[model samples]
Target chain A: MRIETKTEKFDEPLHLESGRILESFELVYETYGELNEDKSNVIVICHALAGSHHAAGRYANEAKPGWWDKFIGDGKVIDTTKYFVICSNNIGSTFGSTNPLSIDPSTGKEYRFKFPILTISDVVRAQMKLYDRLGIEKAVAVIGGSMGGMQALCYSIEQPDFTDTVIAMATTAYTRPWAIAINKIAIESIRHDPAFKDGFYDPDDLQAQGLPGLAIGRMAGLIAYLSPELFNSKFGREYARTDGLYELFGRFEVERYLEYNSYSFPKVFDPLSYLYICKTMNIFDAGRNKDKLEDSFDKVKCNLHLISFKDDMLFFPEEMEEIRDIMIKLGKQDQITYKMVDSQSGHDSFLVEVEKFEDHVRDILKGK
Target chain B: MRIETKTEKFDEPLHLESGRILESFELVYETYGELNEDKSNVIVICHALAGSHHAAGRYANEAKPGWWDKFIGDGKVIDTTKYFVICSNNIGSTFGSTNPLSIDPSTGKEYRFKFPILTISDVVRAQMKLYDRLGIEKAVAVIGGSMGGMQALCYSIEQPDFTDTVIAMATTAYTRPWAIAINKIAIESIRHDPAFKDGFYDPDDLQAQGLPGLAIGRMAGLIAYLSPELFNSKFGREYARTDGLYELFGRFEVERYLEYNSYSFPKVFDPLSYLYICKTMNIFDAGRNKDKLEDSFDKVKCNLHLISFKDDMLFFPEEMEEIRDIMIKLGKQDQITYKMVDSQSGHDSFLVEVEKFEDHVRDILKGK
Candidate 1:
């Protein structure tokens, strides 16, 4: 189970377009490194779907280091010893963040399924507002992977003056048709479950029904997160548990892994939050601007570094090539560099592959 | 809808292990070409999962040619003019073959779920019995794909004198952990349905609960049969239909295609046969002879041709390479040739790709 934390004092409430006031929502964040005297060396790291604010180091007695622990710390990439790093859970997230599960003023009940949908820009704007309230004028660099990569691109385009450099890895400016299809199926699996009750089910009534459908959906997601070659090599025709039950039932290790991961999610996550994050991601597309590649990519002004994996079936290398070609065609080649890494870990390589990824980040920071 | 035709008749009654004699089991067969003087130029082709007796050519009233028509008709690779070809629906198949729907002798009621679980060897033996009754001493070739390929391999190993050449395309000597996992999950989907009742549900009881489960299972099966690249190229996030009913519903063409195919399967297929065929395929491992690679390869006297696809993710090309290396080690390199075709269709390429596959077969037949 995940522990939700709230700050006792908030500077002010946020005013929304609906004329509703969100009174003092806390920003769930995990920080590393001390802020420099000039405060000019702060870097913000965004996370992907289902990722929390815990970006590095052990957090609140957790056994494992945070998600990107390898890339942060005393003398690593970004040199935590020299740079202040602020990573926050998105506003629409469930992990100690002010998501639908937070108490709603309108009814004095948890938002549950009543939270309005959010866009990537909505998330970025909220984070920017938080930074402004905290007296941070700009980030030396903004970086993310997958959904986080998406947030970085959005920030670079929408708030160019606040970020000097942007790094987007194992992600896209927009969700492609294939990615959209995959997300759509996963959402359907969750929503179509009878237990979902149109996303308004009682929290106490959640059952295995919604879990299995969601599990199967996550299994599909896991496939996209992995390369076909890796799957063939590691789990090909291999049983997860070699007891006699497998011979009678035909179970594989990957299937067991997927099932365990999916079931374990609800223990810490709210179902409504899962739905909201996926929906936010579905509407995320960088190619939506002007319906042309040049106009869309031309809108971004941040010094950009784009990276992809050669074996990422979910985000094909060709998409990155297209992005690079567009930046070049738009006469921004000098401002951008594209690197395709060779890894069989697939899209998840962004998190799993740290040394090589940090080295690329350091080289970019050195302006090489 | 596919039309089922019961044409060929078996004269002898067969005794079952169930202590009952089956009066008359019909052989649903499709034939190509005319028999030569000694009837030694006959080739028997077996159908794989969901396949039927119509291996090639169009039926009189149908517009579409048989599934394998492109590679098996006159002037084609399995040239009907040169060698007589016979294709049969396996005993446990629902496509006009003796299956669960067949009447039981004791109760005079449709066996329905009473059908015994079958093995690959059992299916092969049934075909041999059919061949013996047909008065054919030997076949010029025995060829099949996927599950059919398993039957071909079993036939050559169990009765080498009956076959001169064996073509096993896109198949495995044993079911790997991955394949079994996929098959079991599919079966579980069917079994968990309320209407299944341990496969005792009435066939006439349409709109059964198992249909949805079967549809999802088939969708899973279809994804396994396709490559990520093929799906990416064909279905990438192009939305065909959108209703306010759900946000993350299908937004891509391929997801829609998979759902469409799965929905169509229930109109014709019996759920029990699907279970039986899957079980048979899972336990099929011809390499269990546990002999040395050379000894095992040398045990098969028939000429062998193994063809694989580069993108066939289900049966990896590496597996085929292993089989090829073993054949060469046995000094059968002169008699056995291996070919890997480039196709984006994945495992289904053996049926979808014709020109290249047919050319390879023709060259092999001409002793090239």
Candidate 2:
């Protein structure tokens, strides 16, 4: 199974949910395995915030595989051999996509804050266009977790007759207030960074400014990604190496862990992209109205599988149950299934602890 | 009952657990009721981080009373008529205490980052000194919640005979990695603010700088102080007052609520004090070693009452149960009582929803 990435350019304008337009853009995507006749074996995988189109396998020199490598490799649960996998860099994402950091051809300047707000529906629509270019008449299934899960939900509603199945894991049908509140900390941190200069700072100068604001925002986001149980078990009350607890800038092992994971994140990620993506996540409302549950799911033709992690405080398992209940109320209980994996990794379980649900996912992908 | 706040100066240097000293400081405290014969009815109340000595009563022109006004009034739970209550502003708090923003007598400049890191023991010792100044041999009880709860636990062990009872609520015996991780977010937020100026910025210029970092930090802190259920029920998916969710810097009702509470927090709070106090909390361990629980409570003479909020995610109820379990293992089951109040206010229940535990507090104070 050869793994390769290619860019597909579209000269046609993309009308966004915000009523803004992307005059022209490129979608960088990766494909694994071979597309069978008619391309009906295709499985489109959506990536979460901070993720990329490189969903599986490693590059020539990289130490780690892609974000969901363990779950999507040749003989893994997702089984690339059995399904042709396609993953695209989301439009507002920093990874090789036409994001906020991309230069505007008309003005020869980075879009930055000028990047229009995006929604899950907009992201899904762009991927559908990529599918059109790839000659994929319809995907066998659309699979995702977290923000990617939001995109999966969008795929079901936006193109009800396209895919046969939709798998959304560790996410909400709609973003909750708790999640929005957490996003505010990150936005405020970046907005307050003196070096941010209203998102117009030279990319070259970010290293000198330490991107302190972006690092802080990443740190805040990291807290929500993992759970308190994981933190206590892994780094309980431990002091940072070679530092007394009373020393200036002294850190607990947990603080050191956060700084290690987030401090250099700005060098690899775009702050404006982060800000924009968070706004998209904040406004996500798949089942737009609970009172009109039937209307909300009226267009759905795919079999829906809503997978949740029990300990995920960010998205919360109950919120997913709310979606199942809505479908049940609409007399679509037979069309939808909800599974909660007993996990302590919080929302990160879908990526790092996929073993917990690997068998179930394999079965679902098999339509068993 | 009448309430008055007065400052008591101490020429003696205060030794800290960090092996540092606060030389010749003032302890500002508010008192209610009268000292009885032998001065035995004194109830020393401890304040948490961001708290003040003003525990009860309002000024002539003020619209609201003190932080714990409901629980500490003349006929309230603590019952000032029967117990003379004393609440002191912690040394490193932003209130009227000798904090980091206070002038250093030696240099005639603000202490700023020069303030020594404090522990719950140091705070407890300082309050005991105030007792010595008033010629009081001991207090009837030491009561507090959250970080103040840390102090109540400290009083039981630090000065076994200083008080006959210790009521610690919505707090942990030691700060968990989970909590240290959250405090890290706040510290990072404040530290990254360019206006922070290495904690050397002019206090007069903070307002002009907008104190963005402090506001960001406070916003993060506010999240843990509340539970998800409260956020969901109160704000849900409501749009802000005027702007729709798609507007620039557009916000959900919950984000608006957080902004309203945290945006102006820096104007009234000192960032340096916040940094110093968080360090104290991160290192707090009342029962120093689980294996040597006996040693930690060896000289403890007070009856300990540990109260917890059911929804407290910050200082979890299980952590409080761990303390009680330790006491039970030490064969002191009869000496300690644990109470869990069902509430959705999280760690803030100890401050805002004390009504749920008022009867219990009154009974415990009455030795019932």
Candidate 3:
């Protein structure tokens, strides 16, 4: 029931689709629950743009609960009692994993932008290798929300024989137009961040410039993650401080909330890692496989569950329906279940609206 | 009918709501169209953040069309052919007007962030001084969009006798939660910009620091101005150089669009301007008049026209209807018209889809 870490070097080079080769890289991952003797209970949870391998439970007394801590506890849909779970920080992530901030073996310096433009498939491929190393022949399911959903879909298709159940939440098979634009803006914000300095500034010197920029960039993601109504209700023109003698000092509560969100990030996340994950998310479109969506779905060999939210503007529920229909056309209707969760948490319902989302996960974990 | 310039200086210190005083200040403005013999044709146009006195007509041979040129042309709404028009750059804006960027007469240094916080009503009060200098006693209408719309609403309530008719377009009556969040991010981005150097770095030193940070901040605005559908339809998965190539290069049309926008701005806008304008906009809320919505509208002297774009997620059209309903309850129903323009351009339709907006203007200006 506790998350465990594993570290290893890739036996060979990670040949990215761009023809760039990253040689003999180290990967760090963590697994939760217990791997059944047959390893059939394996369920992989992919994290979002800023998430890490810590999807549930605590590693140390000082560490906070996992990213989806609310929904992944005992008796939850992703029950530790019934299933073995694995969550790996993406290769280009900063969480206990090799990423741009990781020291390069050749130069002993952080790779930074020298890190290859990573694709979601590349991350999935690395995860597959980890599965192979762990003796997990085929998983009962692979599930994730947002970028994690992207990986789940990619894994279900590219290596379908390895994953028999795929649940993609608050995501699309391919990066949509608006999502792509938002991704590009986030990247541009990171690149143009003066401290970025073409991604070559000294790590020590880069902190001051890059950290604040990263905070603002993360706040941008926060906007898409939460509902505007929620923001209004919470912040609603409320002032944080009063000048005493007939005056308003602080801004509405929402302004303070966004500031808190932006500032808290630079203290935790690396700017380069933020950029890498965003880039991988933007390039993740299963429909890009063989220039057709069906060709991509044709490779999926799983009981698929496409879960979406009514007010999730970033990842439209309609997009999930399209993916569900594709699975049905592939004659996997009985194996695939599609449900639109009515929630106003925007695209972040999977992480916050645990009561409802947990039920969906339970249905899948129970194989109902 | 030609746009004419006028200037006036405050005889005493102007007291701001924030309890700060701006001592001995000047206001500059331009008038388009013509005033009727009774001066009843006067219609004032308030500009958005960073907008200017050059709201219509050419100022110089190479001058680009004014920001609202599409809305204030010969045959356009607020037409020069009939109603007299007056447009002024706000008191703290950087466009041919007195602002934080202006040299302080006392120390000969730019005010920078030292400029006191200004409210929407304060801006209208400054514009009113320009009218007094031009010998115009009152305006028949007050019209604007975004921050300009906030000023228009403020004028209708704060100075109803001078602003007989009001038109607030593509904007909300108050600084909604989302607007506050965007402004917070923008301000935070500028503060993090090293070239800003706590708002004291030499302008020359900003080329390496302030410009890029400002560019990134502006890019966020570009995303809100356009709709997601427009972005997808125009640049869905189209790549430049090849598929999945991620770098600073523009692979998708939307990338090129955003890149062009980001680069084009830093050349003209200063980091301080970005900070100041964002602060001014975030503090804008006309409904704050005596802390009662009805009390605010009771001061309005004439008809009201509120136009919103249905697809404007940044400033939802539903918020506009809510505002219109407030006007109706104030016994102005017969004089008020609430309409939503169906467009996929989102908040940018006021500039992009001008033809469709012209009809609404015709209805408002016909009697004059």
The number of the candidate with the highest lDDT is 2
> By TM-score, who's the top model here?
2
Q: Give lDDT tens digits, candidate 1, residues B1-368.
A: 12234466665665543344556676787778887787887888988888888888776898778778878877778888788888989887888778877876668988765666566776776777777877899998899988988888777677778887888888877666556645644665566555556777777663443365566567667777787678767865455666331243423466568767876776667887787677677667676433443555667888888888888866777766777788787777876778899888988998998776887887767841
Q: Chain B TM-score per candidate, please.
A: 0.89, 0.96, 0.91
DockQ of each: 0.26, 0.76, 0.49
lDDT of each: 0.72, 0.86, 0.76
lDDT of 2 at A100: 87
Ten consecutive residues with minimal summed lDDT in candidate 3 chain B?
B241-250
- Give each model's clash number: 9, 0, 2
Best by DockQ: 2
TM-score of 3: 0.92
iRMS per model, in Å, is 4.7, 1.2, 3.2
DockQ of 2: 0.76
CAPRI-style quality class for the chain A–B interface of candidate 1:
acceptable
Docking class of 3: acceptable
| Model 2 TM-score (2 dp) | 0.97
